[model samples]
Target: MVRVLFAGTPEAAVPSLRKLAHDTEHFDVVAVLTRPDAPAGRGRKLMPSPVKQAALELGLPVMECDPSEETFLAALKATGAEAGAVVAYGRLLKEPVLDALPLGWYNLHFSLLPQWRGAAPVQRAIWAGESLTGASVFRIIKGMDEGPVLAQSTVEIGAHENAGELLERLAQDGANLLAASLQGMAEGQIQPVEQPQGAYEVAAKITHDDARMHFNVPAFALDRQIRACTPNPGAWCQLHEAADALEPIQLHVAKAVVAGADDESAPHGLKPGELKVTKHHVWVGTATDALELLVVKAQGKKQMGAAEWARGAHLTEGAFCD
Candidate 1:
């Protein structure tokens, strides 16, 4: 068996770790490396990372510390691990740590590589209206996701898929790809291929500003942004109306669709951010079209259909949203 060290931190990495742990014939996952526990939830109690929790459930030894720590390096060396597999490990691995393992490291990234090569690939892909996005397994180099690919698996993005939903599907698909890559490498049948020359896009971490909805863009672009930001910072806009003592409310839109010009309620020639409230929909004007909001969550309120919220707020047809 090839002794392996698994390094990862988030829920997205759990499936890969589980795959390695179960495939005992070819891989012996000696230890798991994850970031230290941090405070979470309302009480702010320390919470173990998803990877650490999964490792504990599998009765595997886990090291929750910085990869740069000397103690961590020593413990990792003691594991006699011949190889390492990384999936969404939050921190970068230093040269000394990488040298400790004989077979080096393989990273399972959630993008096609050289495409969305950064921290938030899944979110960026959806936000950019990418119809196809997939996973890649590559050798970990010093550069950021600039490694040679060992294997890759393509997955189609659904028309209305949100970032969270797409990520869940890719995580499992990535696990399967990782397993196949490791098996091929162990058998000496696979070789890493250098990334092709091209101008690739970067997927920087999503900031607070990125989640704010911009109605000035086309309705399709706004729809993509809304889907990408769901279950995270959430796609939000400012409400100008005052209803039920809620003025200038920050509304998080959960679901929306591009409205057809044929809709009679959709105002013609209205400026972007202008709203048209109807009995069954809340349409907002955009640069090229209007977006019909389906689900929305207002400040200090539970998620509800946009029409329901409009009814309760007494929003008129001429109301505007910033």
Candidate 2:
């Protein structure tokens, strides 16, 4: 059995850590490395990361320290780990730390490497409307996700799946792949392949501005944006009332769908950002087609059906979103 050191944070990484711990035959998880507890929730009390919580529950020793510290290498070596597995640890490991273990470290990334190789791979893929995305187990190198892949598997993106939902599925599937890859390495049955040379787009972290919805774009693009930002810095737009009595209210779009021609609720010849409310649905115009707003949250209000919110707001005829 290979003595393995696992490093991760957040709920998404819990499955991977649990997988390695439960597979006692091929691996022995010596210790877990994770970030220190930080403020969370409404009261801002210090709380341990999901990985840290899981490690404690599993009766495994846990280390909470930044990987860049000078003592990190010594601490890592003392764990007697021959190899390491990282899953969204949220820190870059330098050269000395990389060489601390004899068998080297591997990372379970959410995207197919040489593409979406950055902090927000899953979000970027969904935002870009990628039909296909996958998980990769790659040997860690000096650069960011610029490593050779040991194993990989492809997955199709669901038509209406948001980033949060897709990530939940990927986390579970990636856990199995990660465990298999480590097991194969221990048995000398798998070989790492050098990544193909190419200039691929980076999945840079998405900001609040990046999540803002612009109705002037095509309906499909708007749909992707809304889905990409569903449960994070949610997709928002400025609700412009007919009279500028108050500043534009922020509206968070929870769900939306492109208005098909057969839908009787969809208004015809609506200009961009134009709002049309029927008894059952609320429709907004985009560049190419209208979008049926299913759920939305107005400023200082709970999320509700778009038509319900429209009725409660008493919006004027020219009221719209931008």
Candidate 3:
């Protein structure tokens, strides 16, 4: 049996941690290290991390440690774990912990490394108009997500996949990949491959400022940005609810694609932020192209089809959307 130390702290990390918790025959998960619970939701209640919840349910010792501190180092070393596995732990592990694990620590990152290395991979990937993104299991090194990869798998970037949906799909795929990587590690068949050097893009963690969509952007860019932030912040644009009354409307651009550019000199004369509604969907005009909005939510309203929003709300064609 291989003694494993697992460090994780979110819903994204829960699947892999649950996998380890059930595999008592193959993996002796001596301790589960996770971040402390913090305020969450509308009431701002302190919520336990999924890993912490799962670890306690399984009767395993759970350690809430500051990732930057050495708070759990002694307890971690006491486990006699030769290996450590991390998934979305939300903090960088220090050199001492890495050195303590003889077999080395492995990280299951959401992106295909050297690109989207930071906290927000899926959201940033979509926001950056990336055609594809994948998962990677790499040996933890000093640099951020610059470690050599043990295994990787790719998935197509669906035309209008939102960050939340994409993350759910990737979580399952990553769980499978992590299992395979662990098997290879035990058999000594897994070899870390060096990361390539190139003009890689960084997926900086998405912020409140990022959720603010600039309607002046090309339709394609605005569409991607909307899809990227959907189900969380929901793409928003400031619009007038009535005369002299500016209301910020949050619309979920649930579907989109590259459109309208037939040639280099194609004509796009539509005024940006111009809104149009079809029988089935709502189309928002952008600087370069037009985006088809699928789901939309007005202030004090539930999310629904764009056509529904058009029907319920008295939206006019000449109405301005900032």
Among these predicted structures, which one has the highest TM-score?
A: 2
lDDT for each residue of candidate 2 in 70-118, tens digit (9 for 90 to 100): 8888888899999999999988999889988999999999999889999
lDDT per residue as tens, model 3, 1-322: 7788888887888888888778777788888888889899879999998889988998989888675666667777788888898998887888987888888899999998878888889998888878788999999999898889999999988777889888888888898788678768877998889999887877787776777767787777787777888766667776654445555555444455435556332224557777665566566667877666667676667777777878888776665477
TM-score of 3: 0.87
Candidate 1 TM-score, C-alpha based: 0.94
TM-score of each: 0.94, 0.96, 0.87
Which residue pairs overlap in candidate 1's backbone?
Answer: none
Residue 240's C-alpha lDDT in candidate 3? Answer: 55
lDDT of 3 at 249: 58
Worst 10 residues of 3 by lDDT: 258-267
Instruction: Looking at model 2, report the run of 10 residues with the lowest lDDT sum.
Output: 240-249
Error (Å) of candidate 2 at residue 261 is 2.4
| Tens-digit lDDT string for candidate 1 (70-93) | 687778889989999999989998
Give the count of colliding residue pairs in each prediction: 0, 0, 0
